[model samples]
Target chain A: EAGVAQSPRYKIIEKRQSVAFWCNPISGHATLYWYQQILGQGPKLLIQFQNNGVVDDSQLPKDRFSAERLKGVDSTLKIQPAKLEDSAVYLCASSSRQSSSGNTIYFGEGSWLTVV
Target chain B: QKEVEQDPGPLSVPEGAIVSLNCTYSNSAFQYFMWYRQYSRKGPELLMYTYSSGNKEDGRFTAQVDKSSKYISLFIRDSQPSDSATYLCAMRVQGGSEKLVFGKGMKLTVNP
Candidate 1:
């Protein structure tokens, strides 16, 4: 019954500094995702993990961003040398296997980051 | 062109009024359509999900998908102040790769 859980609801760092966000998905959920939502914009997927394995990360900026789900239950997204453009909300979401009803992804409160 | 396009509106309307929001997608491969509502500083929550086409109604919210026109719409009736939030339209292809392409989100304010 518990939804996805995230930590450090808010964060602020200077440009070029590093920041990380953690997420613990719903119990028994097998798929996890990390998304970045800039102010006034929709959420943009950064990466996806399917039980410890990456499913997609094509949109992720490898030069500065990285994420991992080691055990498949929890995930962490990191950004190094953060830029002002990187200021956004990091949202973690999870979902069960695809079914006839379709995959319904549930999101956490998100970790807000502001790079000064 | 972007795969999905939605007007970013900070629309304000009186309470109890009917509201309509829409999005257009360029990808014909997208088989699943969804609507998510997000409040300030919060994550997005799923509001509606539809497969393929046609219309699906839930309470005061209705979602319609027109694949031929590559357009999708969400209609809210008797809106309340609580319904004020940013609405996003998302879509994805069926089967492998659960990547969802999202719109720019439309912000709505219902004044009582």
Candidate 2:
């Protein structure tokens, strides 16, 4: 089975510019997530999608960030007027099941964004 | 106080040495614990997962969880250069959306 897939592997943008990243989770996986990992920090949850609906996005910066999982298969995370602090690795992950535990979360290589 | 605390180490060790990594959490509701290893510029992969408290070993890796103290540990036996990467500890409550709360990853380098 194929793992989660993401692109583009790296991105460079200037402050106030807009950027977007795409993710394709493993087939049959119902849970998809987007996380932001600043340098020297662990990945922080930005948003989560269960099927085609939103599950949790309380931590998402709604003023600048937005994400959508269309058709419950692929996802896209976008950031407008990107801040310098938004320069981080954008990770996409998916899980086969939606229990509190047991299922493994598989991640992509991540999209590295550098905002100047 | 943070929900989870991990010593962010650029710890260097020689190959064949025993490596121990750990994390502590403040949330008592977190009943599921997991460890993930990430290579530079890459995303993390699950190394192990433990429910409640106890020890779970997979090959050369061992994970220990202590709910009473809210502490968790990961041990790599006979470390290898391939083991060089960042190790992250994550946990979540049993219900609701069950999103994971992660700690600052600890960087480990196993020398040849």
Candidate 3:
């Protein structure tokens, strides 16, 4: 089976510009997640989606960031007026809801964003 | 204090050696613990996961969690050069929203 798929493996934008990343989760996985990983730091959850609805986005910077999973399959995360600090790797992951036990989650290769 | 503490060591070890990694957490409510391996320019992949406090083994990897002490560990036996990567520890608090609290990862290199 194929793993998660993400577009634009790498991106570079100006600090004030807007950027968006796309993710297509595994076929049938009901849980989708977006994470930001800075250099020298672990991946931090930016948002999570259960099907087409959001399950959690407490850490998301609502002021400049927004995300959505439409039709319960594909997801998009956007950052407007991006900041230099927003430069990091954006990772997407998926897991089946059957895993109430919190089993393994598969991740995509990630989109590396660099803001100058 | 950060919820999780980990020593970010760029530790180098000879091949075939035993590799041990650990993380300490501050949240007593965290019940599920996991370890992930990330290669350069790649996303993290789950290596092992443990619930409650005990050890779970798969092939050369072993994961251990101690709920009483809020400590977790991952051990790799007969390590190979392919095992060189960053290891991350993550935990989620029980009875609340399932969000993972992660520690700064430890980078390991297995010399050939």
Candidate 4:
């Protein structure tokens, strides 16, 4: 089985510019997530999708960030008017099941963004 | 205080030695614990998951959770050079949408 896949492993953008990252999760996985990891920090949950519907996005910066999981297989996370603090690694992950227990989450290689 | 606290160590150790990594959290509602290993420029891969405070072992890795103290630990036995990576501890509260709360990862380097 293939692992989660992400596009454009590295991205460089200037402040106030818009950027987007794409993710293709493992087949049969029902839970997909997008996380932002700043340098020297852990990945922070930006959004989560259960199939084609939203699960949780409470921590997302809605004023500048948005994400969607179209057709339940692939996802895209976008940030408009990016801030300098938005320069971080964007990570995508997926899990085969949705229970509060069991299933392991698999992650992609991440898309690193550098906003100048 | 941050929800999670971990020493971001560039922890260096000789090969074949045992390694211990740990993290603490402030939330008492968190019921599920997890440990992830991340390589350079890569997303983290789940290494262990434990619930309720106990010990679980797989191969050369062991994970321990102590809910009473709000602390967790990961131990690597017979560490190898390939074991070098950043380790992150994450937790989630019991129900609802279980988005993980993670700690700043600890970087480990196993020397040859």
Per-model CA lDDT versus the true structure: 0.95, 0.93, 0.92, 0.92
lDDT comparing candidate 1 with the true structure: 0.95
Looking at chain B only, the TM-scores across the models are 0.99, 0.98, 0.97, 0.98
Question: What tens digits encode model 4's per-residue C-alpha lDDT throughout B16-74?
Answer: 99999999999999988999999987789889999878999999999999989999999
Docking class of 4: medium
Model 4 regions more than 4 Å off: A98-101
C-alpha TM-scores of all predictions: 0.98, 0.97, 0.96, 0.95
- The model with the greatest TM-score is 1
Q: Which segments of model 1 are wrong by more than 4 Å?
A: A98-100
Model 4 C-alpha RMSD vs. true structure (Å) is 1.5
Candidate no. 1 TM-score: 0.98
State the lDDT of candidate 2 residue by residue for A1-116, as single tens digits. Answer: 89899999999999999999999999999999998999999889999999999999999999999999989999999999899999999999998775454777889999999999
Interface Cα RMSD, each model: 0.8, 1.3, 1.5, 1.4
How well is each residue in A3-115 modelled by candidate 4, as lDDT tens digits? 89998899999999999999999999999999989999999989999999999999899999999988989999999999999999999999876545566778899999999
Which candidate do you rate higher for TM-score, 3 or 4?
Answer: 3
- Which residue pairs does candidate 1 place in steric collision? none
Of 1 and 4, the candidate ranking higher by DockQ: 1
Q: Is candidate 1 or candidate 2 better by lDDT?
A: 1
DockQ for each of the predicted structures, in order?
A: 0.84, 0.78, 0.74, 0.79
Top of the candidates by lDDT:
1
